[model samples]
Target: MSTAVTRLFIPRDTTALAMGADRLAREIAAEADKRGETVEIIRNGSRGMFWLEPLIEVETPAGRIAYGPVDSQAIDSLFDQGLLQGETSHPLCQGLTEAIPYLQKQQRLTFARAGITDPVSLDDYQQLDGFNGLKKALQMDGQAIVDEVKASGLRGRGGAAFPTGIKWQTVLDAVSPKQQKYIVCNADEGDSGTFADRMVMEADPYMLIEGMTIAGLAVGADQGYIYLRSEYPVAHQILNEAIDKAEAAGFLGDNILDSGKAFHLEVRLGAKAYICGEETSLLESLEGKRGMVRAKPPLPAIVGLFGQPTIVNNVLSLAAVPYILSKGGQAYADYGMGRSLGTLPFQLAGNIKRGGLIELAFGVTLRELLEEYGGGTFTGRPMRAVQVGGPLCAYLPESQWDTPMDYESFQAVGAALGHGGIVVFDDTVDMSAQARFSMEFCVAESCGKCTPCRIGSTRGVEVIDRIRNDEDREANMELLEDLCETMIYGSLCAMGGMTPFPVQSAVKHFPEDFNQPAQTNGAQS
Candidate 1:
């Protein structure tokens, strides 16, 4: 008689870790051992459904069944409930993992392997069609790979929406030794409502490794670095593990796959500077300098990282390359609306029922995400406004919920999709307070490299305070608008350039909030 080993999956993603998944995992293993049962526990990444984290899954003949928000004390009960046999009688039983509506709705191109495979497991990643893109890339020349990315219409997912292929082509075209050129990934995902980058790094680090390898091959660079945010300790550990594993497997470093191609990748922690999210500023931080913005013209594509031509891409943008190369660029291009092609991993945060990640084609309406996926505000109050693309983006009211989640469409509405982060706010939210907070955030986070962002943000906050206190309300309003215009065009980078978005949007959409008496804690009345 053959004894079967029960397979159990637990997430080690940061959110799950914060929810005590590590303790739950150890407890589950202890209980299984105490019961004289054989169990194979695998630590996977979060499913992006954060509310259901510590989500445990068991492999059954039928499929993987899920039970979530599992507590350490519940481990014995789960085992007693025949969890190894995939029993569905437990109160936390969520049935088939894939059937969860929140996950089912996402297109998940860039995040295809997240939450499914063991994070840092080279074997598991390979089994799931992982390096097919790198294999395909190995068979093609540099121009061919760049052309493929261009055909896919992939823009930088870090918020700029600049064509990624064009950036690669610049580095490819620059007159520099292959060794001098570099590939830098901006993993400093500090924006509010954003964790897609963190999830990708923690869940499927190899996908990023493979993608960065492809970028190196295409851009004639053999070295790469991921400037990750220091806040994500879990991601740092997972990425380092994946890198070591990949190097040992010959998928990274020194003659990869014995194909005579060589690429090396490493992770460097950012100084927790929000301005470092900018391409040039990130380059500065990567070189051990203070994180600050650099002037354009000699763009990062021309001079970056050690003053060599570099290809800087966001984590999601690099993560998308494997899919584009494997499935063919046209397949990805066919998914989204005009101009913005391929999938975008939209993060739902703030006051929302289902706050997690949703990767979809670019044209989905905000109303669908808010009403259907998010299920409205977590406070159970009506959603007053939604901030699309982080704190630097505009505060969109309910009236603008129909706007499409695309670069051009968002721009058409006088907003920029800084990053695919949507922060929902309830009716009790004060747009005026939010506007002030935007300036305050900029004030605190600014690199102090430019006057408009460093100084203008301070003045903007004071102006909002005056308006809130009803001191020269009308005149201050006009002055605030003028100041915003200067910051929008005068600031060195998006840190100051985009800070006015929330301020402008607030005054435009919810003027009544500004006129009302200031509430305690500096919130709206």
Candidate 2:
């Protein structure tokens, strides 16, 4: 490898970019030019440590030294402190990157290469065991590949914790001389507190590409589509560029490394409809139709995109494929507990200190995540409630903080580990208002295809208003509970079905918020 006179690592993730990483990058280059120094700048992804965005790293003989929350204004001072030489005396110096507690604590399986390499560089990706999984997969028959994933105990990282191997097997078995098969990667990551999908697409695009390629080989698919959200412009550009690189490098397209297997991939932008995050709705949107939820019985596995056999997976799920194929399924399964095997990229957001992505094995307690990784609330006040999963997940009170981050554990408490997102709320939050907001959110984002979610949510808002206004308080409360139950069992999809999770959870956990008579805005009951 050619030695650089000096090397700098700055993140281009949307979070970092929003924090002025782009401006800081330009300033660092200008400072180096003025000093007549040769510097190599590499734009890597964030290590999921959000509070320290615009995190700068300098490659040294000892290791990579880090500095964080840096802006253009700090470049001159950082350079003055001999940052290029790896000096740790600067105020912003964070010592070694890996040694950071937040990062060191994470069991980064899917995100192993994130924040560590040039995202689009094929050679850099290959040097880090990137394509080993694809290579191993190429040597195995389709049944062997499917069997390995089945043995891994890998469930969907997407909201539905369905068995991934079973989905692949159905697609594999559905294929015949006349049937076409496809693989779809759900990159429409709209869940609150979730950025794991966008991170993989932007930081290590090749990992996702390799994973999808393996899926193609396993299920007899020749075409794949990544349905990415339009909000992620940076990921869109990076993924498109990565797809081009992969196609040119023979990792994708008609022939795969001269193996005579065809796996062509493309990125399709979502219509910015939250409902499209659901698989059938996403398929409907992909076909140039209005985004609406579809009824089941003809599952997407058997009748998906263009009415063909398909495998629909989340970005995080597909990204894990490379590692599983490389090190064996059992090795990947060894990390977590119970049916929830393997690591999950759990995102910490909202009113939390040190909020970032924390990917760990299943079974970590919520208390540990909220206190240890989150460092409690950002405002330093006592935390009152936390919404695990996403906007529709149950609003867990502090009493339920001991719940483990596993499918069955969460299910036992009438909660879920949907998308592994944890959004915290401080004690000052009003659960009454929050309950109403859940209804409003569901009404706004609902696809109008289901009656329970569409009409029930509007009624839910009215019931909450009645309870807050003390209009037949006990009766309205009963009506509200009845409405939630109806939505949970009657809706066509989670949009209507799961909205009650947050509504009821708030009422169940913080009864005081709904028990009081009407009061002036912002007044404590």
Candidate 3:
């Protein structure tokens, strides 16, 4: 008689690996062998509950039970306490995986398959409705597919908040002389404290593939490219592997599913440039040119990527297409508040406990995420400032924390929910220095193609230094504001345009920081 084999799952995501998951996996196997028991280990993606990384799930009659932050040293104790049988008596046992409050509360539409299956398994992907969107898109006309996206009320999740469907419709309606169009997925996610795009690429790569394939069908594009950041070595490898697997299974490449419709996809590594996160700059980098912003008149939809019409979208926006196609547009439209339909995967990071990804509907307040999901600051100090969006975004005070997280709501408060990267800061943070760093960051990353960004950022830094040093403080403060206006309106791209957001917000919300007494040796208190 054959003995029944026990199944165990450990995450192979970057976070888990950083926490020594591979070592833990080896130890578990050795312990099982010493006991003469049969065990199967499956490396799955992370569930985004980063605090409990290397979370091991044992398949039981009840369900997958969770135990986490597990190390090699704990393997012996865990097994002795009936870990294989999903016993909850162990100190590390977190009960059933699905019942965890952090994971249970998330809507998880785009991230549905994330952490639930093997990252590169095509079978695992198909079993969970992976290519259903592409299957449906193959049957519908291009116009119909575009219409579905329009009705879904989806906007760009890459911080711009532009209507995605309208951009698709533009590409669909554009006339290409060379009969060529492109679908570019901006995977160069350079925003500070953001890892949602990397999580999708590493945890559920096929979702991005399926979403991009549907985009090809919707916009009549035959080729797609994922401009991934060079920093993400793991994501690059996994994306390439998933693409190979998908193509072999007939989900990508020419004559997909034998429908005679063709779509080919490839992954290209980007040069380490923050400016490349901008769509036009990304296109320039893809074309082997200097990554510089292109002026808008003939939008990318009409003229892009070797001068052919192109559809450029963030990874989350494209990843969302699969769901919009599978469950009708209105189905997705039913989730969020007015205009900001569908769920957003908010990535919590910085000085916060319980930091990870939380996908919720639009109307959720920032206070809810910080308090309930974040559980307050990791240092246990009073929370001071919160930077939503990226380095270019404003530093919000406690008063603005109550605002809803949608595009318009954030916009109304002179803030943005850019890429859903929320970075927390404790009371020890120096707001004036942070504001200065924003200008300095622009100086370091600017492409020098525009004067406002290139020169204004350098001057802005000098002015902020003067303010901090108490050198004609009143005159310099006024000069700083005037210079910010120049950069805001005179810059060629958001690189220059949005640099003033953090500096202006710091002076507005935390004036005390800027008005501090001058230090003796440039030392900050």
Deviating ranges (above 4 Å) for candidate 1: 1-3, 177-179, 520-525
Per-residue lDDT tens digits for candidate 2, residues 17-51, read: 99999988988999999998899899988888998
Worst 10 residues of 2 by lDDT: 516-525
Model 3 stretches astray by more than 4 angstroms: 1-3, 518-525
In order of lDDT, best first, we have 3, 2, 1
Expressed as tens digits, the lDDT of each residue in 344-376 for candidate 3 is: 999999999989999999989999999999999
Tens digits of per-residue lDDT, candidate 1, 1-525, equal 343898899999999999999988888888888988999999999889887888999988788899987897787788789899999999888999999888887898878889999989888898999999999999999999999999999999999889999999998999774348999999999998899999999999999999999999998899999999999999999999999989998999889999998999999998678888888888988888988788887988888888899999999999999999999999989999889998898889999988888999989998999889999888898888889899889989888889898898889998867778989988878788899999999999999989999999999999999998999999999999999999999988888999999899999999888887767433354
Clashing pairs in 3: none
Worst 10 residues of 3 by lDDT: 516-525
Model 2 stretches astray by more than 4 angstroms: 1-4, 517-525
